[model samples]
Target: MNTTQLDYTDITEIRGPLMVVRGVDGVGWDEFCRIDTGDGQLRHGLVLEVDGDLAVIQVLEGTTDVVAEKVAIRFDGAPLRIPVGDGWLGRVCNGRGEPLDGGPPVYGREMSSVAGWPLNPVLREPPSQPVLTGVSVIDGLTTLVRGQKLPIFSVAGLPHLELATQIAAQATAGGEPFSVVFAGMGLTHADAAFVRDALDDRSAAGELALLINTAGDPVIERILTPRLALTIAEHLAFTQGRHVLVVAADMTSYCEAVREVSAARGEVPARHAYPGYLYSDLAGLYERCGRIRGRPGSVTILPLLTMPAGDITHPVPDLTGYITEGQIVLSPQVHARGVYPPVDPLSSLSRLMRRGAGPGRTRDDHLDVAAQLLGALARARQARELAELIGAGALGPVDQAYLHFEDRFGRDFVSQRPTEAHTLDQTLERAWQTLSSLPRRELTMIPDRLLDAYYRSDHG
Candidate 1:
C-alpha cells in the first residue's frame, strides 16, 4: 500500500496538453494525480516523467486555460486506481471504469492500482481448462487455456475484426458459468458498433460488459481501457467466482498511446519510435490474467496487436511476443488468397497448448493428428514449390497428389470464416476428411481406430 500521500504545491507551466510541477516527492511514473483550479474545479493527470524534485504530468483532461500559479496537484501516491466489483457486469464504463451507462459509481469495492498484476500461486492447480470460441483453428490447434495470456497478432487488411466479432458472439466453455469483459482500444465508430451490435443481437451483451475508447478519444484513455476491462474480469473470477474471458483489441493503438504519453513527458524513444518501457509496459497488462488458487473461476486474456505493414519484427509485436504466452497470428497474404481468419499456422503457436488439449478434453488423437496434418501440409507445400521449379508437366503422381493436398488445405481449411466456426469434434472430423486424400500407408502416424473412424473418400 502507498503510504505518506503528498499535497499539491505549484505548477510551472501548462504546456498544451501537459503540465510541469514542483514540490512533490514519491510521485512515481504513471502515477495519477488530481489538479484543482483552487476554484472548485478538478482535473486528472499522470506523472509522465520525474526529474529529482520536478515531475512532468500529462493532463488527461488537457491543460487549457488554467493559469500556472493557480494550479495545485494532489499526489494520490499511486497510479490511477479503479474499483473492482461484481456490480460492474452488464454495464458500460469509461476508460477509467466509471460507469458511462448511467449506473452507480464504483464505490465500496477494494481499490487496486493499474500497474503490476496479481499472479496466481504456483502451487495452485495448473490451467487445463479450455474456453472454446467455436473457431476451428483456435479450438483445435491453438486451444485457449484458462489463465493463459494469448495475443492475436495481425496486419491491416486481415479479417481480425470479423474474427473478433465471431469470438465475442460465440465464445463459450461447454455452457458453463462464464462471462466476457470486452475492451476496444482506438476502435473506429463502425468497429465499435460492430462489437456492440454483435453482443446486443446475440443477447449476450447483458452477460457481456464493455469498456470502449474510440480512435478519436484521448490517447491516455487507451491505457486505461484494458485495465478497466481486466479489473472487471478479476472481479468476476475472484469475487463472483465466474469464468471470465477478457479481450483487448488493437493493442497496436494501445502501444501508440504509450508512445504519446511518453512523448508528452519527453522520454527517450526506442525501436520504431516506441517508448523504452514497452516490454515491461505490456507485461504489466498481460501478467494480470490467471486462475487463482482455490478460486472456482479463472480469468483468461486475449489481447490483439496489429503488426504494421505485416512486419512481426516491429517493436510492438516483437516485445509483445517476448511477454505473452503465445501468439495467434493472422496473415493478409493468406487472406488475399481467400483464407478466412487467415492464420499462418507456421508463424503462430500456443505455448500453453498441451494443458488444454487431449483425450477426454478435446479428443484422444488431437495432438498426434494435428502434428501429422501439419507435417503433411508442410511437405505438400514443399512439393508444390518443387513443381513450380521443375514444371508441373514433369511432376510424378505423388508430387501431383501433394499439389492437390496443398490446394485443398488452403481452400477447405484456411478459407473457412469464423462465422462458420467449427467445434473441436467438427474440426477434427474435417482434419480426418482431408487426411484421407493421402495414401493409407502414409497414415502410419494415426491410430488404427481413428484411421478407420475418419479416413474417408471425397476429402475435397
Candidate 2:
C-alpha cells in the first residue's frame, strides 16, 4: 500500500450519519491520516465514521474539496492511541488524549488503544473502599464507593456540569489509591473547556484522563467515546490496581445516540421513545464498576444523565435508579436559588451508605449528623407550610424554631462556597453549627454526647 496517495477505496457516505472510506490494504481505523485537497493542501484526519471493512476519517479541519480522487491516508499501521505513562500526572489532553494545554506530545513511548477491554474477574477486587469527594452532601451522606457505578441525575440548565467538575477535583480514595477518567458526551465546547480548566486549577491535569465527545462531533463518536474511555480505565484499574474513577457526563445524549442507532437499524421503541434495550445497555456500562474478587485495582463510575422535564420517572433516570447505587439529584429550583451544587438533600440517597461511612472512612458522627439535619429540615419544611394557613404568629415555639432551622439548612449547610472545596469534616462541623440553632430537646436522632458537645456552641 502506498503511504502517500491518501489512499483508500470504497468512499461512501452513510448519507447523514457520516462518511466511511475503506483503506486499500492496511489502513487502520481511527489512526492518524491526511488527505491532499483540491489545491495541494494536506488535511490531517482520523480513521473512523466507518462500516465493516470501511474506515471513516473525520477531517478536524472540515471536508470541503478532499474527495476519493485525491485523498490519501497514511496508515500509521496502528490504532489511534495516546501515551499513558506517569507523565500524564500534570498534563492536559483533548478528548482524544492529545495534549491540548500546549505541552509537547507525550513522547517516545509505547502507544495503546484508548478503547480498552474489561478486566478479568479472577484478578479483580471488590470496591469496598470509600472515595470521598469532600462534599458533605456526598461524602458524609452518600459516600462514593470505590469501584461502584453511582450516577448523578439532573435536569437541563442545572449546575450538573459544574458539580461534576467539583467531584473530579476533590475526589479522593484511601491511601491515595485513585485516578480519574472523565468521559464527556454531547457537551458543548465551552462546557468541555470549563471542565478542563477546573481540573487544571486543581493541579489534577494528569491524574484524570478526559474523553470528550463535543456536541458538534458525530453522534456515533459520542457513543464510542465513553466505551473507549472505560476500556482505558479498565486497563489502568484492574491491570495496574489503581482505583479509577470514570465520570461520564450527559449520558442522556449517550442514550439518545443509542436510540438513533437503533432507529437507524429500525428497532422497536420503549418508554419515552427510547430503545427497548435501554436498561441492559446501561447495565453493560454501569455493572462494569466493581471489585472483581481479588484484584488490587478498581473502577468506580459516576455517569450523569439529565431527565426530560425533570422527570425521575423518565425511562433514562428510572432505569438508572434501579441498576446502580443511589443518586445525587440536582434540583433546578435549588440551583436558581444560588446553591452551588444545588443537590436536593431530601430527594437524594445513597443505598450503600452504611458500608461507606464510619470512623475509619469518615467521622463516626457523619451518619447521625446527616440524619439529624435531614430530619430537622424535613420537619422545618413541614412547619413552614403549616404556617401558611395557621399563621407564623400563632405557631408554637417548636414550629417557629423549625422554620428557622429550615432557613439555616438551606442557606448555610446546603449552600456552599463556589470556589472553596469543603472537606467532610468542615461540612459536618457546619451542619452541626446550623443544627445548633435548634433547642437541645429537639435533637432526637443525634446521640446525647454529640448534642452536648456540638449543640451548646450556640449559647442562647
Candidate 3:
C-alpha cells in the first residue's frame, strides 16, 4: 500500500526512449513512474537520473505517440518490482514480466525488485556440486559447477542457440529439485518460437520459465529480459528452495541495447563505444548467482554471448571473461564439420571444474580421463598440422594413429544428436572408447590403475 504519489507535467524534452521532466522535486533515482498518453494508454517508466529539478525517465514502453503537452507523470517513489512466486514456472512472459502464454496473471504474496540485492561474499558457500549439462564436451571436459557463472562464447551463424536449448532441456543437478529460467534477448520471432518449442516438454512439466524479448520488441526491454528472468530465478532459489539454472542467450544483444541507451543518454563511451560502466553492470547481473551458506538451493548461470566478427577480444566477451568464472568457446570450424555443440575444448575452460569433478563426485577416474583426452587431442591436433605440411603418407605410425584419434574424438565423442543426453558415466565411457584407438603409452595423463581398468588397445 504505497500511496506516495508525486505528480509532474513539466515535460521539457522527449528523446528516443528517454523523457525529461523538469520542475520536479522529491523524485528519487530508479523511482517507478506512470505516464498517461491522454488516449487511454498508460505507460510505465523508471527515473534514470535526478539532476536538481530535472528528472530523466526511461519510458519502459517506448514513447511512440506520447504528446508532450498532454502527457502526465506520476512517480511511485520506488524502484521497479515484479511479483514473485512459484506460479511463474511453465509460463511464457515478455521482458516486462507481462504474461504471453494467454494465462492469468501470476499470483504472488510478495513483490521483488527486478534489480536484485547482492549476495554477501562472506555468506557464499564454495560451489562444489557438478551441474551436468548432458553434452559430452561440457560434462566430460569443462564441467559446469553449481552456482558458477559460465558463459558460452559463440560467433554469428553458429549453433550456439541450439546447444543452449539442448542444455536447458537436459541439464540436471543430481537428485535436487531442478528448474530452468530461460531469457532470450533480442531474438528473432523464429528463434523465440524455436526456444519455446525446444523447451516445450520441460515447460509442460512445470520446470521451465521463459522470458523472451524479440528484435521487434522495444530495445529498452532487451535490457530488462535477463533481469526479470534472474529476479524470478533468485526468488525460486532463495525463497522456494529449488536449484535454479538461468540460461540467458545472446547477451550481445543486451549489451548492444545498453550501448543504444548509453548513446541516448549522452554518456561517455568506453571501448567500442560501449559505456564505461559495462563491466560493473555485467558484474551486477553475474555475481547474483551462488550458493548461500545454510541454504539448500543454488542458482547457476550459463550466459551465452556471441563474439562480434569471431573476435573474442571484443569488449563484450572480453569484459564477460573478467566477470564470469570461465567460458565455453564454440568453434566455427567444428560446426562446419557437422559437430554438434562444436565446443573447442582447447579454447574453453571451467575454473570450478576441479572442485566439482573427480573422486566421489563424478567418477574416481574422472579427472584423469579428462586430462588424458585433452592430452591425446593436443597430440592429434599437432599431428594433423604436421600431416598438412608433410602429407599424410609421410607421417610416422604414432602421428598417423593420432590423426585417426582426432577424427574419432570429433565424430564420436563431440558429436551427438540434439535429443541425445549422455550421463557422466556414459560420457566417460565414450571417452575411453575413443582413447582406445591410440597407443596405451600415449595416455600419460591418466593413472596406470585407471588405464589397466578401462583401457583396451586396438593392437591386441
Candidate order (TM-score): 3, 1, 2
Ten-residue stretch with the least lDDT total in model 3? 1-10
Q: What lDDT does the true structure give each of the candidates?
A: 0.78, 0.73, 0.91
Tell me, what's the RMSD of every candidate? 2.9, 4.5, 1.2
Which residue pairs clash in candidate 3? none
Q: Each model's TM-score, in the order given?
A: 0.90, 0.81, 0.98
- Compared with the true structure, what per-residue lDDT tens digits does model 1 show for residues 1-460? 2257656667776665788887777678878888887777888888877887788887776666777877878877778777766666677666767676677876745876665475745735577768898877787678898888888998887778778778867888777778888888999989888777766744334677778788877677788888778877877888788888888898899999888777766679988778888998888888788877777888888988888888889998888888888889887777888778788777778888888888777788888777777778788888878878999879887777777777777776555755676777888877776776777666667788877776775434
Error of 2 at 159 (Å): 1.4
Comparing 1 and 3 by lDDT, which wins?
3
Cα deviation of 48, candidate 1, in Å:
4.2
Candidate 1: where is the Cα deviation over 4 Å?
Answer: 1-9, 25-31, 37-41, 48-53, 64-66, 75-79, 100-109, 116-125, 202-205
Best by lDDT: 3
Clashes of 2: 19
| Residue 296 displacement in candidate 1 (angstroms) | 2.5
Candidate 1 contains a number of clashing pairs equal to: 0
Backbone Cα, N, C clashes tallied per candidate = 0, 19, 0
Runs of candidate 2 with Cα error greater than 4 angstroms are: 1-13, 18-91, 102-126, 203-205, 457-460
